[model samples]
Target: MRYSPVLDRLAGLGGAKWELHVRARERIAAGEDVVDLTIGNPDVPAPADLVEAAVAAMRAGRTQYSDGRGEHNLRESLAARYAARLGRPVHPNQVLCFPGTQTALYAVLMGIAEPGCEILVGDPMYATYEGVIAASGARVVPVPLRAENGFRLSAQDLAERIGPRTRAILLNTPHNPTGAVLTAGDIDAIGRLAVEHDLWIISDEVYEELVFDGVTFVSPLARTGFADRVVVVASISKSHAAPGFRSGWCVGSREFADRLLALSETMLFGNQPFIADMTAQAVSRPSEAARGMRARFAARARYLADLLTQQTALGVHRPEAGMFALVDVRSSGLSDRDFALGLLDAGVAVMPGSAFGETLGGWVRVALTVDDDRFRTASGRMVAHSLSLSGQRAEA
Candidate 1:
């Protein structure tokens, strides 16, 4: 048997970031005292009501397969929430629930992009997007977004990149490594381009509720006249700190929703009924609980920012929103990978920016997943290591 060349290519682009995390986890299990800052899995606890809801749901025997689109109740509930949040009225049929945002994103690519198509992605983007696009055999066009520009996506820049073969644009706002939110103006510009180019837009607003410092997250699809061509992939993973639940949803026009449903049937079969029930509860009461979790991430981001500023070797543009901070160690002698490995040897774990892509080699990523006390300790350790590396480089 032979595998596709695209799958082979994706396989070669190993998930080094996750591999390092597993190694770090093993070290911790072996009593090595590793401070993990690799993965962005939120450390915050899920809401008490959510937990109780899941327990009740399981007890009520709702653990079987659900509607491939979603359990109707949960789909309607999430649709209603999105309608209220985006201030755009939508019907329940416009939504499709998936196991998580990853599945939803993959399904979007499968449903929309053709084998020879292209997707415009931020250069230093979330790594999973690369593999997802590759698996679809679509060319993943790199759109370079720099930290100097606050990781903002420029319309003129993207305008030059989109072409006839381009089928869709993947917008991960409140972005992964940088936590940069797309402003209303940015969304409006992208909306205009999407309309003109006749391109489908996949808006990954998973971190929509995690904004900080008064930064608002604007979705590209939230604008008028783009809803028909837009598919929203969102989850309770980051916002509710319930990644383990594996519950997420996609929303679009009824046509797209049906296409996603057919894709889900051939791909996923359906979502877990128990998880859907729990998420329904979470989406319905998504006010105070969501706010409190965002506040915790904000506090962590501030603490890490202050610590990074002390080490002149590391330039930190504290994310305006989201859970990860992209700390630039370009001034230090070591490349991003060596610096991360150096920290690992120091019993601290961090993600090298190269995991995002080659263009991001000058930075290291730190997750604010740990609690405050641990975050302070990790930040201190990182600063010390950065200064030590700087001194060694100067001496050389």
Candidate 2:
């Protein structure tokens, strides 16, 4: 049996994170008390209004196939939202809705990048980006987002990595795994570089509404001079706690938006009409769902960060925003993978930092999607595991 070489390439991507998640789930199903925290799947209930909107849409006979560019009303709502958020005029024709941000990302990568091209992504990025880039026949060039620098991409690093082969830069704010939000200065630097090198910017603002504390999110599209080249992708999945809705959209220049719509037509025809209508309802209505979710997540993150800091010797970097934090487990004298497995045995599950990128070998990502009680239990178990490992090292 043979497969395309692309399949072989994807096989090496994702870095075994899924395998760990599956193992933890099997343990739980076998009656083991596993405190799984590997994935960022939100456990919060979907907004009642949004759920009702979906039901009403179905009742109103919106289940039919939609136009290849998504429902016109939904696209218009997204354009208006972006216009208010970015302070720039975004037309309905410049918005392309998709089933998920991942799908939108793939479409943008495939549309803008050709074979043998390069896409620059920050290190410690979401693993799915690498898989999508590989599937598009383009290589991923990682720009290291070092822990010493708070896991933020530096302008100098970006400039050094850009070459004739570099066609796009994928930016994730309130970044996954590390929870590092890009500062305003960072956005400015990146926008300037994109214009200088004539590269497309695929800004994943999925976590745009999940910022913690008093921090404000600055989108790449808000940066001047790169409006024509920046494709902003976002969803209600994180912001509205409706991942099952599979609703997201891509906003860019009118020309680029049409390319995304064309690619979407051949790939998915269009997003589910009912889902689009439901998403439009969520976007149009005034609601505090995002604020409530952000507050809950911030509390969970702070509780876990304090526990890790006080109960263990591990170096903890508290997240500025988002629903996850990174802990430096190198002090345990174990690889990040081994440390995570050890924690699983101790009854808690986490993702090894290496799953994000090779440069993150000494860390582990702890998600705050669990409830307060579960998170407290998991934090205690993780602390105990760290202490046990420290004792063993002392004996050696």
Candidate 3:
């Protein structure tokens, strides 16, 4: 039996990176005492009113197929929200709803790039990014997001990577694995480069609402001149604590949306109308959950960073926003996988940096979504594991 070449391109791309997280879940399900900090599955629930909205829609028979462009009201709601962020008028026709940001990204990538083309993306990106570009038959050219620069993608390095085949530059703000938010000035520069090179800018702003105090998120779309060249993919999953709902959308120029409408319809005509109804409310209002989450995540990140640095050689590359914290374990004299496996044995589970990118070797990512108590315990265990790796802690 033969399969699509895409199978090879996407082979072992997603779940493989999450293998340790999966193992942690299985062990916990079997009654193990592990403190799982592997994935950023939010600990909060969707806003109560949003849930009721979905129920009301379902009872109203919104279960039928929706237009490929998404529910009109939902698209209007998203447009209004993005209008404030982008500082411009946005039309409903420019928004295409999807099951989630992952799907939206895939559709956008397919619409913009294809075989023999390339997408310049940041290293240490979210795990599925490579697969998404590969699925579009586009090569991923990784630009280093160095720690010294706070993991913000460098526009100069990006300019160096540009070639005839470079079709686009992808941006993820409040970035995954490393929660560095790109500054406004940098976004403007990058947007200028995209304009100069005549390339697309795919901005993933799912964490737009997750940014912490004192840190602002700047989108290329917000930089003014590059509106037509920039497309944004975001979801209510992280912001509204509604991951299970799987509701998201793509925002771009009306022409870009028109060109992708055929693909959106062919792939999945539209997201569930009930889900759109729920997401409409989510997009229209400020997310109380996201505000609380930002405060909690910021405090928890500080707590864990202080704990690791004071007690062990491990130091955290403190995040300005997002649900996860990155711990640099280079002092432990072990690879990221070794450090993560050791933490699992010490009754804590986390993601190795290798899962994200090779540039992150010897680092591990820990989710800040766990409750304070469990997170504290996980912090303690991680410290002990670090000490054990340094031969400073005796095995019990």
Candidate 4:
């Protein structure tokens, strides 16, 4: 059988991290003890109230399909919350709901990008974005985010990469893999560049609520003139520990939202109404669940960062936001893939940085979603491996 030629572009989609995750899970299933930190699957349970709300919704016969756009209540609830956060008026007409943020991101890219057009992405971006962009018939132009710059993407970098065929800029705040949160000033500069270039801004703020150490999340929509041009994609998976619910949203201009809804209609008849109800409850009600999750993740992040920094030769950066840290393994004298496989052999699993971007070949990303004890054990093993590598180098 033959497949479409376009499918060929998805050749290296999941990359090394996903492959390691599969291998680690296989080993664990075969009775091997492995501390897996390769994926950001939250170990924490969802809030009790959220679970109850879903049950209530199901009992109330919300199993039927909602409007293709989303349930009215959920959309309004999300709009109000975003309005409060952005300090501006965000109407329900400007919001589109999807079963997952990943799907929402794909919809936005498909809506905005044309075949052969370019989408500017920062290096060390979310792994899924690459495949999604390629599938959308768009090319990804990655701007390197150097460790010396604290892995921050600068306006000058964006300016240098913008070309005539550039149609959009995908920005991830509290960025995955690196946990680098963009400041308000950084957002302002990038917004100006997007506006100047007449490019659409697809801001992936999935980790907006996972910031650590008192760092505030600044949405691109909050910038002065870019509100009309930016589409903010976020999810309850990270914030509410409800990945199974698969609820997420896109906020943008009314026209953009309408277009996305039309695309979503063609893709999915509609999202699950009961899940939408549960998501509505999660976002509308003022609960301390998300705050508690953030605090717990922050503590775990700090613990792991301190352990890696003190006990290993690897360079560790304590992330300011999000639930992962980037550790440099260049001193180990191995590529990121080899280093990750070695850790897996040591009974631990972590993502090789090369999976995120070509420029991050000497790094590895460790998740903070695991329990304290497991994370500590994994950190110890990594430290021991690093020491052995150092010893071998010294002897040679």
Candidate 5:
């Protein structure tokens, strides 16, 4: 029996990057005392109000089918919330709800890109990005996000890479792995390039609400004159600590959403109504849970960065937002994967930055989502590993 060509390429696509993380888990399951800091599961629970709202909606029978654009009330809530944030009016028609950001991205990619086209994504991007672009029959062309630039995607780099075959620019701010937040200037400059090229701008803002103090997140959707070109997908997963709900929505021009409606209807035909209702409530007001996460993540990142810097050859690149921190393992003279494997022996499991993209070959990412005690213990192990590497360097 034969399968689709897409599945042939996507067979556990990007799964190889997690081999060390998987091995670490296997060791722990075998009763070994390994500290796994690999994935970013929100340390906090879903807010009580949002959870209660979901229960009430379920009991009231919100389990029925909804249109691809999702419940009108939920769309309305999203529109209003975005309107406030963008300081512009937004119609409910501009919002399309989906199961998660991942689905929204796939649908958006399918809607905009096709075979032989190119999507310009930053290097060291989210791991799943390539798979989605591949599934869309579009090729991903990586534009390196230099460490010197704090890993923020630059308009100059995009300008250098834009070509006739380039159909879209995928933007992820408050980015994963590196946790670099794109400033308003960054968006303004990048949006102008999108306009010049007449290319679509697919913005993944799932981590928008997770920005740390002293950093402001700018979305292409907020840029003037690029409304039609900018489509943003965000969710309550990180903001409200409701990843299990699978509730997310896309915000684009009314025209884009209208066209995407057909594709979405064919895809999942909207998310769970109960989850949408819960998210409607979640986005209508401020998120105290997110606020706490910001503080906690910031503190943990700083502590780990300082600890590793002071005690070993490792250099930590403190994040501007999100729940993961990157440690530069180049000084240890090991590839990121090898360093992660060695760290596994040290009783800590972290993600190799190379799993994200080529530019992160010398870095490893650790989650700040772990409890403080575990994170601290993991930090100590990393320090010991770093010291050992330094000792080897001295001997050499």
Candidate 6:
């Protein structure tokens, strides 16, 4: 059966990663151990208090339908927590809760970007962004984020890409696939451009707390002029390892929040009361668990970068934050797909750079969301194979 071209456009986007992950699962099922790193799921446990809160909520019969936006208490808790984290006060009405950040992002696009409206997005962004834009019948104009520039877009680059149909710009910090955090200056420039062009800003800061080496995260909304047009989407998934709960929120002005909340209501009927309860508890406490999570990711990131660099053929973009590395494997004399598949065949798993976009074809995204020993083992094999490939090329 034939499918829509839009469906076809997404055909190979994420299938390969899971295809490899599933193959790894099969091997383990058959007693052949494999180390999988393709998925960016947190391997850590959620805070004990938060888990207890969810259990308590379940016992207290909070498993029913929640308000379309969220529970009043949860929304209020979110506003206070975010305001403290952001160093700015946010009214409770401005907080709109959803199942997760994915829903929040999709709802924002559906509510804001009209058909044929252009969204300026990063080339090697999370693939779902493309899917969301396509589902909305909007076009995504990918701006180049060169590794030479640490995978960041300059204000000039942003300015050059703006056009008549452009509706908004999607920004991800401690970026996925590369983990390149945008500097405060870069964010200021983006805000200035947003103000100058009267465009909307959709900032994804899910990895805000995962920054390392004194890297501070500043949101576009932190700027004065762009506040009205900015929509900040965040989740408790990475921060608290509660992805299963599907707890996330979109923070901004009341009008934007209301519009998105209404869209979310139509999309999901209502948020889960129990999940809201758990997330509310998480937001209220702001525990040491967040710090523990970041430290683990940072250590793994340092280990992987150091190990990969030992092999002259394997080049890794040092992860300033988050749990991933964009390792250049073209130097290993293999296409991204082949390199990923080869790793899978050798009892390892990883995501090909092409999954993000064509411009990143020479790389593979290494996820550090696994046990340290397993990650180290996989990295060693990859590096050894990469060096062998380089040696062969040199001999030729």
lDDT of 6 by residue, 298-395 (tens): 88877877888865657888777887877888777789888888777777778888888777898988888888888888878787667666677889
Candidate number that wins on lDDT, 5 or 6: 5
Estimate candidate 5's alpha-carbon lDDT, on a 0 to 1 scale: 0.90
lDDT of 3 at 243: 92
Q: Please name the candidate that would achieve the greatest lDDT relative to the true structure.
A: 3
Residue 331 local lDDT, model 4: 84
User: What's the lDDT for candidate 2?
Assistant: 0.86
Per-candidate Cα lDDT values, in order, are: 0.83, 0.86, 0.91, 0.86, 0.90, 0.82
Q: Is candidate 1 or candidate 3 better by lDDT?
A: 3
Error of 2 at 75 (Å): 0.6
RMSD of 5: 1.2
The lDDT, on a scale of 0 to 1, for candidate 4 is 0.86
What TM-score should be assigned to candidate 6? 0.93
Residue 166 in model 4: shift from native, Å? 0.3
The estimated TM-scores of all candidates read 0.95, 0.97, 0.97, 0.97, 0.98, 0.93
Q: Tens digits of per-residue lDDT for model 3 on 1-396?
A: 999999998887788888899989899999999988988888788889999999999999999989888999899999999898777899999999999999999999999999989999999899999999999999999998898899889899899999999999999997998999999888988988999999999999999999999988888887668889999999999999999899999999999999999999999998899999899988888899999999999999999988888888787999988999999988877789988887898899999998999889889999999899999888888777777677754442
- Is 2 or 6 the stronger prediction by lDDT? 2
After aligning candidate 6 to the native by TM-score, how far in Å is the CA of 54 from where it should be?
1.0
Per-residue C-alpha lDDT of model 5 across residues 147-168, encoded as one tens digit per residue: 9999999999999999889999
Q: Pick out the ten consecutive residues of candidate 5 with the lowest summed lDDT.
A: 8-17
What would the TM-score be for candidate 2 when compared with the true structure? Answer: 0.97
The true-versus-predicted C-alpha distance at residue 56 of model 2, in Å, is 1.2
Worst 10 residues of 3 by lDDT: 387-396
> What digit string (tens of lDDT, one per residue) describes model 2 on residues 1-396?
988978976886775667778889999999999999988887678888788988998999998988898899999998888889888788999988888898888888889988899999999789799899998899999999988899988889989999999999999998987888899899889989888889999999888887887787788888757788999888888888888888998988999877677688999888888899889888885446678768877888788778888888898777877778788999898999999989999999898898888879989988888888898899899889999998998899
